[model samples]
Target: MAPSRILMAAIVLVGLSGFADAPQRYVVSYSVSDHGVAQMRGQALISEEGDVSVQGSDQDGGHAFNATLNPTDDGLVLVTSLWRGATKLGEPTLAMERGGQAKAEFGSDQQRVVIEIAPAD
Candidate 1:
């Protein structure tokens, strides 16, 4: 093979390898419904390891929570105590991947949050 051709092939292989090594990214979003009333909506970026960095806002403009949802053996786990600027909420909520529903109780009200995490198209 020609030396120039071999070098060009090597460069192409290295560039492709860089793309292969890039981490997988997922765009996840969620909707919070309080007894069927929409309360908050947010989206997040999920890495290959299922580490979530979320940004959310209450639709009513009174409260907000920025929390991390870590993937677990069963599903995604959320600790309500880690919720910023909120109280009277449930703890240790699990968003099952197969079930597709994440719910928590705030006092007498129940908040059911739907989480969707699909591969980027």
Candidate 2:
């Protein structure tokens, strides 16, 4: 099968397995070295099949964002954006860590941001 088809299959399998119930909303604090400190409140949905969806926003500007993390045989894949609607503003495939904590890195027109997510409570 093609790679895209396989990915689609995995997504479907993960969705059907009910992994989406494992995560919940939480507050995450992140640091951007030269920029400053930023905090966001978002939801993390962990599926039974190893898929994760995390979303959050900056309270000051209401700039919301979300990310979907999918675990594969190799590692994890991450997709993020800065919009609330169905349309994704920015989608970048960033590196991720397995098991305990995961991290994502992406660049925008202005700056580069790295996000780290710990296990949801």
Candidate 3:
């Protein structure tokens, strides 16, 4: 059997429309891939906060995904909890800054899931 891949992307636009040159729009792109193959992808425009999820079936088996995002005290950064089949993955944090990024990989010998968040250009 082959491994499955899931990619999620999130983009946020804040502040007034007049400020077009301003960096008010934050882009968050999530990518979950294995062996350069992608089975799922996601993108979102968040005002204050946002939630993105993807569910589908591939050659391996069925897949289910769920997640919610919330603002942090420092601003421009978000945090969300991860779960894999009732197992608490972790409280991963999301950052809009290019220097600040988060990533985590989990799975067994049969399968591997790599979750990554970037500045989304």
Candidate 4:
């Protein structure tokens, strides 16, 4: 599939809206894909408090990544720690916003897309 087509396919699946008073839960999922082959896949549930817990894996095996999304002066700050077993890989921080949809690409030509899907109330 073409890059655009693949991107469109990976668009976030949003659910129905809920009551205004309740805190919303968002299901965020993404895959690092090259030519339709998923090199790594991850999914996370982001609470209203901005806590993010993600589990993902590649061909070698699985790993866990944890990050805290806190409100910042710009938008939001995501501090990520990647782990394989007990070994800590690296920490990459990104400042971004939570909105409708967004897309990003890695250095290896792998496409990463983020979709925020809220649960029905």
Supply the TM-score for candidate 4. Answer: 0.48
Q: Tens digit of lDDT per residue, candidate 3, span 1-121?
A: 2232222111123333345653333333343455556544444433335666555565765444544545566654555544444555455565544234456565553444555554444
Using alpha carbons, what is the TM-score of model 1? 0.53
Give lDDT per model, in order: 0.53, 0.50, 0.48, 0.53
TM-score of each: 0.53, 0.41, 0.45, 0.48
For 3-110, candidate 2 gives per-residue lDDT tens digits of 999999999999977765554432222222223333333445453234444444444344455566666677555555554344444555554445455555565534
Model 3 steric clash pairs: 8-30, 9-42, 9-43, 10-28
Count of steric clashes across candidates, in order: 0, 4, 4, 0
| Superposition error at 99 for model 4 (Å) | 3.9
Indicate whether candidate 1 or candidate 2 has the larger lDDT.
1
Give the per-residue lDDT of model 1 (tens digit) for 38-79.
Answer: 776666665444555444454433444334456677755543
User: What's model 3's TM-score?
Assistant: 0.45
- Highest TM-score scorer: 1
Off by over 4 Å in 3: 1-48, 59-61, 75-99
